[model samples]
Target: MGIIRKTFYTTVLTGASVFGYLGSTTTLISPLPQDDPFWRSRSFARYNVHHNACTQDICVKRIPLDKIRPELLQKEGDLVLEFCRGVWGGLGYKPQRAYLARKYQGPATASQLWTSEQLSKSTYERGTQITDHFEVVEKTPTDIVVRCGDTPRNPNPRDSDGLFVISAEVDKQRNEAVLALKSCFFNSGRKVEGIQGPTPGWMEEAHRWYTRLWMATGAWRVTR
Candidate 1:
């Protein structure tokens, strides 16, 4: 089915009427337009400098394993995130802080323990470290959240032990197809994750969608 043709939601969106079972009326509540939690929680920069010297625009990119000078790692104290792709979470984004404590067989003070009870045994084994660390953004100690990063559901090619950013992955992973889809929605004063459009996926797409909406509806537009 075409993307637009695809219903906003499944079953839940479609009301039912049989045996007096009034079409499911359980309303789905997301966040608001102006305060998208996901975007707030996970947002990074992709840098590309095009130097046009009236001659030609040359892109200065740092590539790895290509006669490169040095390999850099993103480190902050006990936290160490390896950068495979030349790009790492730049300055714009901050680490998530909505940490979830793992039910450990070891010490409880162990902050970043991967909860095998929450995740899987293999996932726990592969874990060199675990974290419940996250960032709290907004009023009322409650804000945009990033949960359970000290472990993974499964340490396969996709799942890694580190901060999980939906935006960066969506764009960097491949062509910005999914990201474009998200750009279709994003309303002003819509209260971040409002009970409206925009589903979960990668971050770039999420921001693209948000930025698009912010632009279209003039969310950030200066009105006289």
Candidate 2:
């Protein structure tokens, strides 16, 4: 009877957890659309070569600009920047930063290392290195692309030096803006016989969940 009661409670908790995750505003797209500009880009093609095992996904949220408060609409660029800033400000990105800080004995807060103006400038510039090993590789008015881990900039990336591409785009159509956070990871040395070229299933699942949480929180921050 005790075992039965425990099993019942576990099932209920699991179901509730799943329900809560599904209730978030974020949605995920896997194997990103083939014809999309991002997928067709030379940079993407380079990272997705035969020697690399790549995994790609996108988390998306839509916001109706008309519904936003007047005070938040002071400047269009500010809103875009706020959304970008909010992405890094969320729980998903914080733990890694905190961990790195503890490991390196460095300042944990962005304020300690960079002023607001400097951070913003670096965030938008190509070739600029940001926190968490992310480097800005591409930028446009509505989009920014960052490469993390072993980037293409390295002439010879190690087999263990996997690479990740993280991008944020705000696509405006009519009165709504679609916010997308696209992520792609490349496991180096796919051709090696015994190489672990693909991301593990469990890690991929965890990444998707965290990304959803991040997108939802970022959207809430920008919209609020």
lDDT of each: 0.23, 0.59
List the candidates' TM-scores in order: 0.20, 0.70
Q: Give the poorly placed runs of model 2, Cα more than 4 Å off.
A: 1-23, 46-51, 69-79, 105-123, 150-174, 188-197
Error of 2 at 41 (Å): 2.3
Best by TM-score: 2
Query: Which lDDT value does model 2 have at 173?
Result: 54
Give one digit per residue, the lDDT tens place, for model 2 in 86-146: 6666555667656655654344334332233444343455666555356666666556666
**Model 1 Cα lDDT, one tens digit per residue, 1-224:** 66656664444355323212211211112222345343343321110011111100111111222221222112221011111110112211212211233233245435443333322221122232343332211111111112222233332211111122211111224322111111112222113333433333465344433333222221101111
